[model samples]
Target chain A: MAFGIGSGIFFAHMPFLKLNGIPGTTYRVMPGLISKRLTNRLGINFQAESFGNNRQKGMDELDRVLDRGFPVGMLTSVYYLPYLPKAFRFHFNAHNLLIYGKQNGEYLVSDPVLDFTTTISPKDLERARFPKGVLAPNGRMYYPVSVPEKVDFNPAIKKAIRWSGFENIMTPPFLPFFGSRAINYMANKVAKYPTAMDERKAILFLGNIVRMQEEIGTGGAGFRFIYAAFLQQAAKRLDNPELSLLSKEMTGIGDQWRDFAFSAGRICKGRQAGNEDFKSIANLLMDIGDKESAFFHKLRKVKM
Target chain B: MKANEVPQDDSGVIGGKFTGLKYATDENGNYVEVQSIGWDAEITVLSQAWDEVNEQAKEALEKVKAGQWSTLAYHSTKCMMNEAMLSEYMDMSKAKVKEHLYNPAAFAALPAATKEKYAEVLNIDLNELLRAE
Candidate 1:
């Protein structure tokens, strides 16, 4: 999995940063890191550019690159992308997509999560590229500059897996809002939300979490599940039985995350039956945190 | 998840407007791309979010009907924008945007060109900018 090889699975529950008035949780590394880390690990020559205040110059450069027949990745805001579903468009500035070709004043877009390719008008694309505030894209784009003819995969996969295993398993004690710790941290915080915050805000906060978890681009699965898929593929090539077993366990953990989303969704919809309240969901999160804590540690010890 | 096990439960929230790709195990136990027509959990959560947004817009529309807030307030809330964002887009200070949203006297004193700017940014005509229909 390019995702796991890039250490994409993470958990961060941020209360200090507010998004749309909801305290948000981030499930992956920052927007650009996965590709950056993955390319670096694979020794691929990658080139990226940011236009800063020079957007027209950025567009010209983008045109120049596309003229050379390279599809470039761009950081964009979802809110101005008219091709997205009405339900999916928000002021989110970290959405990434590919611009492959231009035709008749529209750019051909291969948005990562969508089932089909779409097109965006130049003006709309410009609006999506420059949403103000909070991790603004600033007309950023990246493309691979060159590719190596030969490479070894087994060692690279093992190194990446081990590195990511430690990354998820070893967040420090003081910054409790990070890594697997945040899963447990949120488990504790969910209990206080009902009493600490107003009813609507509490519900919206949980909804925001669910949005991050099941966001359409994640292929309707948690990163753990995606990582598990990666592991299964890797195990076959590596002939590693231990990884196969852990992959199954990771799938189970992913199921638990879906259960969390289900229970939290019920609460947000005001359909929580007798057992679907905050306490039960908090317990569910604790159970998930424990499983993940054990899983990552074991993953770190895998013989590779 | 296995290909067959992927949820087909429609939450009545997209109604076929959107489809996403999922990674699921194929019959041979290899991973493959499986298109999903929205999952139950995601639909439930996103519906709650949209409900809140639309509900707030409705309340703002009511407030506009009652002459409590200017139509700028109604348009901004309906578009899921806050004063900070609107201010940035309008190139006005946040306090000035607040006045445009709330203070009837300040809004009424706006010149035609200023109103045109708001109308353009909000993607509404001059008539729609005057009041919420």
Candidate 2:
């Protein structure tokens, strides 16, 4: 599954990187990276371009691609996508959507977060594509020109798992903004929030953590459940019982991740859910960090 | 999570207009994709983040109203951006961005072309931007 092979599980709580004055806390890497990883694994021939400072060129290229009846993936600023529910449309610039066709000057869009496909006017699409800010897409459009047939899945699956292992567990711990170490690093930093910052700001940081974890298309727990589900499917396909066992454990861990979210929510909302405070919340993250480190370590050793 | 265990609570800020896809296991212990309406805890945290944005925007609006800062401060906060990002988006130096955001005089003295550029990037009309509200 793309979820496991995408190698996107990550953690960061950098005070330097500010998102609307809230300290940076992310659960994954850059957007669209999962599909990029999938394309690489599939050996698919894809053409992706960033039309910086040339909006019309990007639009013309998109029309040309769609005239050939190919769906194109576009990196956009979610805030400008009027088709999206507006209540939560922040200034995220890396949201990916598919543009399959143009009719009556509106581009037919298929966003992963939505249940049904939507349409965007050309002007709105241009704004979404060229919107400025951090991680701006610069009118990026990507589509696969060719996908090879008769490709084997075993090697791809193994390679992806190994890559995730290295990316998640084996990254050097000295770098405190990535991998299992970052999870621990955040856990430790979060414990100091109350003492280091104002109470309201500290709570806002916790709320930001939960928002970053569950927001968008992540299947909860910074994608632990999705990864578990991926492992289960891979187990059946590869006929490996060990992966299934790991999948079950991962599911349980995903449940723990949910526990962390719900408990943190209670604290943020000030609902007084059994005295669940910042220290306990930090402990929960520390626990998840330990389990994830162990899980990835075990995964690196599984004889695929 | 099992297929049936997928939360159907559509109580998020998105309301029920859209659904999110989540991965779950079926009765056969096989993986399946499930559509989730949303979850309450997720809603709580998400709303809190947005509320912070709204609060900061509200505070900046007050400052702009009091002539303490330029409308850029209010617009930047309302658009969920900060001084650095406003600079990055407008392609101006950080010092100028800070000056234009904090000093009404700097914002008033901006050239018409630069003001139009700011309006375009901020998704506001040139007239609305000139009105400083």
TM-score of each: 0.94, 0.93
Best by DockQ: 2
TM-score of only chain B in every candidate structure: 0.90, 0.91
Candidate 1: list runs displaced more than 4 Å.
Answer: A271-276, B26-30
* DockQ of candidate 1, scored on C-alphas against the true complex (2 decimals): 0.63
Residue range with the least summed lDDT across 10 consecutive positions in model 2 chain A? A270-279
Best by lDDT: 1
In angstroms, how far off is A241's CA in candidate 1?
1.8
Q: List, residue by residue over A84-186, the lDDT tens digit for candidate 2.
A: 7887688887788999898888999999777788899999999899977677889998999999987777788888887877777767656777777777788
